[model samples]
Target: MHMNTYSEATTSQLPIPPTMDEDLENNTEVCDGNNAMTPMVRKKSELVVVANNNSRLQMLRNFMTNLQEVFFGTKLVVLFPAVPLAVVANFYSFGRPWIFAFSLLGLAPLAERVSFLTEQIAYFTGPTVGGLLNATCGNATEMIIALLALHQNKVHVVKLSLLGSILSNLLLVLGSSLLCGGLANLKREQRYDRKQADVNSLLLLLGLLCHLLPLLFKYALGGGDHSIATSTLQLSRASSVVMLLAYAAYIFFQLKTHRKLFDAQEVDDDEEKAVIGFWSAFTWLVGMTLVISLLSEYVVGTIEAASDSWGISVSFISIILLPIVGNAAEHAGSIIFAYKNKLDISLGVAMGSATQISMFVVPLSVVVAWIMGIRMDLDFSLLETGCLAFTIIITAFTLQDGTSHYMKGVILTLCYIVIGACFFVLKTPLIGQSPKASFGVKPSFEAITT
Candidate 1:
C-alpha cells in the first residue's frame, strides 16, 4: 500500500483510486473530504489511526499529552535528585530523624496500595476489553512505584519491587490463568504456541538466573559480609549482560516466528468491538504515579534517618519491602487476568515485563545512580540470589506440566510467601562479618555481630 505524499488532498488526475469512503454502507467517515476515516474497524495487525493522526496538529497534541506524563512524573517528587539532596541536607536540618521516620511509615505502603488497587480493576477485565489497558496500567503503576523508590534512595527495595512482580506474574498469575482456563477447556484442552512458549520460557528462565546470580556471586565471596567492592560489580555486570542477551533473543524470536504473542493488540477488524479508552487509563496511571512518587521520597528520607535508630538494615528494606511497592499492580493484574481465562495475556505480563525489567530497568537504574554519584550496586546476596533461581525453576517446572491446576497456583503462592519470610527471618550479612543468629535486631548489636 503505497501512500501518496502529494500536496493536494484531491485531484482528478490522481492515478490511483481514492482511498476515501466510496459508499454510505456504514457511515465510514471522510477527512477533509478525502481519505476515509474508519474509526471503529478492529483487526489484529493495525491501529485505528484517526484520520487526523498524521496531521501536524494531532501529533503536536499527542506529544503534549505525553510530555504532560513525563513532566508530571518529574515534578511530583523531583524523583531523581530529591532524596540524595534530602540525605545530604540532613546535616543542616533539625529533627531530621523524626521527619524521616514519620514520612516513610506514612508514605510508601499507602501509595503502592493505591496503585495496586487501581491496576486490579483494570486487570479484572482481561484482554477481551483491557489487555493493552492492563499492560499500560501496569507500566503506569511501575513508574509511580519506581519514582517513589528512587526518590527514597531505597535501591534494594526498588530491586525487590521488580523481583516480587516477576515472581508474582510468572508463577501465581500464569499458573492460575492456565489452571482455570485449561480446566474450562477440559473437553479437549486447547493448546497455544509451543515453540514461542518454549523460547519465552527460556528467556524468562535466564532472566531469573540473572537476578539470582548476583546473590550467588556475593555468597561465593564469603557473603555480603565482606566489603570487597569488585564483587558487587561482578554480580551486576554478569546479571545485566546475560539477561540482556536473553531478552534480545525473546524479541527476535517473537518478531520472526511468533507474532501471535501480540495478536491481541488492537487492529482494524475489532475496532468496533474494542471498548478500552486507553488515554483515560493512561491518565489515571500517571496520576497514581505522581502521588506515589511524592510519598516515596518522604519514605526514603525518613527511612535513612531512622534505619539505624530503628535497628533495621537497609538490606531488609530493599529485599522485602521494595518489591511489594513496585510490582503490586502487576501482581494483581496478572492473577486476575489468569482467573478470567486470558492466559496468554498473563504470560505476556510475566515474561515480557520480566525481561523488560531485567534488561532495561536494572541497567538503567545503575546508569542513573552513576550519573547521580550514588554508589548503589546492582548485586544480591546468596539468599536473595537463591530465591531468584527458585522462582524461575518453580515457574518453569509448573508451566511444563502441560496442564494448569490449583496445585500449580499453590506452589507459586507458597514460593512468594517463603521469599517474604526471608525479609524478616534472614540476618543481614554485613561486610567484615559472618552469618550470625537469625534476624531480630537487638537494642545492642550483639545478635548480628555474633
Candidate 2:
C-alpha cells in the first residue's frame, strides 16, 4: 500500500504545464536541451536613449552662455551690428564713404575685444607668454591693413599706415596715458621703470637708424640714379631682416633672462579673473582676426574714395584717421590703466606697442612685400621720415627721467597735433606716384583757358 501511494505522488508531480498567459509572461527565459533556463537580453526603449543624448547637449548651451558673457554688456558691443552692416553695404555697392565709416566703427570693438581675449588667455599662460602674445598681436590691425595694401600694390599706403601706428602709440597714446595718470594722481608722483623705457628707446633708435640709412642712401648718392633706388630697396630689405632678428632677441630678453626688469611695474591684482577658457579665447581671437581682415580690406579699398569724398588727403586719411580708429581701443586701455596709477601697464601698452610696430610690424611688412615682388622700401619720403625722427627724439627725452607729468604729456600731445595738421594740408598723389611729381610744373593758365 505504501509503494502504490509513493508511485501515485511521483506521477502527479511529473508534469504540470504552464497556462497560456503564464507562458507569455515567462517567455524571457528559455529551456535548453539540458533543461537549464537561459535569460535573453533586451534593448532599452528609444525614449530613454533620446534622454541621454539631450543631456550631453548641455555643453553647447554652456558655450553660448560664456560667449554672451564675453561679448555683451559693453558700450562697444553696440557697434557690432555695424560689422554686418558694413558687409552688406560693401556687397550692395553702397557709397564708399559709408563703407569706410561702418568699417571703422566695426573695427573699434573688435580691436578692444582682441585685447580682452588676450588678457583672458594670459590667465592660463604665465605673464611671459602673455607679453609675447601681446607683442605679436598688439598691432594686428595695422599689420593686416598693411598686408592688404601691399597686396594691392599700394606700398605707399603700407608705409604711411605703419609709420602712423608707431607715431600714434608713441606720441598720442603714451602722451594721453601720462596726462590722464598725472591728473588722476595729483599728490602722488607718477613714475615708471626706467630700464624698460631705456630699452625701448634704444630699440627705437635702432629702428630709426635702419629707416634713415635707406633715405640717406637715396639722397646722399643722388636720387636721379636708378641704381640708387635699387640700392635703397636692397638696403631696406636687408635692414628688415636684421630688425626682425633684433626684435626676437628683445623678446627673449624681456620674457626670459631679464624678465624681472620688465615686471617691476606690474601691479598684482588678486581680483582679476579669466572670463573665458583658453580655447574659447583662442577661437574668438581667430574669428575676430578674420572679421578684422574683411573690414580691413574694405577700409583699404575705400580709403582713396573716402578721401576724395571727404576732401581729405590720402596721407591724412591713412596717417591720422586710420591709426586713431584702429588703435582707439588700445589707446583707451592704456589711458585707463594710467588713470588707475598703473603706469607700468600703461607704458607697456604705449611704448611696447610703439616698439613692436617699429621693430616688428614695419620690418615684417617690408619682408612680406619683398616676397610678393613689391618694392616696399623703408624710405618714407622726406616729410614722413622727418616727423618720425622728431617724434622719436622728443619721446626719448620725455621718458629719459622715468618720471612723468602733465606738462610732458601736454608737449607730446601737441607734437601729435602738429603732425596731424601737417598731414591734413599735405597733398600727395596715390601710391606709385612721387610726392614731388604732384608739384611738377602746371600748364599755363592761358593754355587751360584756350
| Deviation from truth (RMSD, Å), model 1 | 18.1
User: Model 2: per-residue lDDT, tens digit, 145-222?
Assistant: 999998898888899998998899999999988888898898999888888888999999999999999877766665
Among all windows of ten consecutive residues in candidate 1, which has the lowest summed lDDT? 434-443
- Model 2 root-mean-square deviation: 5.5
Q: For residues 324-398, what per-residue lDDT tens digits would candidate 1 score against the true structure?
A: 545544555556565655555566666656556656566666656555666555554445556767877776676
C-alpha lDDT of residue 198 in model 1 = 59
Residue 431's lDDT within candidate 1 is 25
Stretches of candidate 2 off by over 4 Å are 1-57, 435-450
Q: Please, what is the TM-score per model? A: 0.57, 0.87
Query: C-alpha displacement of 350 in model 1, angstroms?
Result: 2.9
The 0-to-1 C-alpha lDDT of every candidate, in the order given, reads: 0.53, 0.85
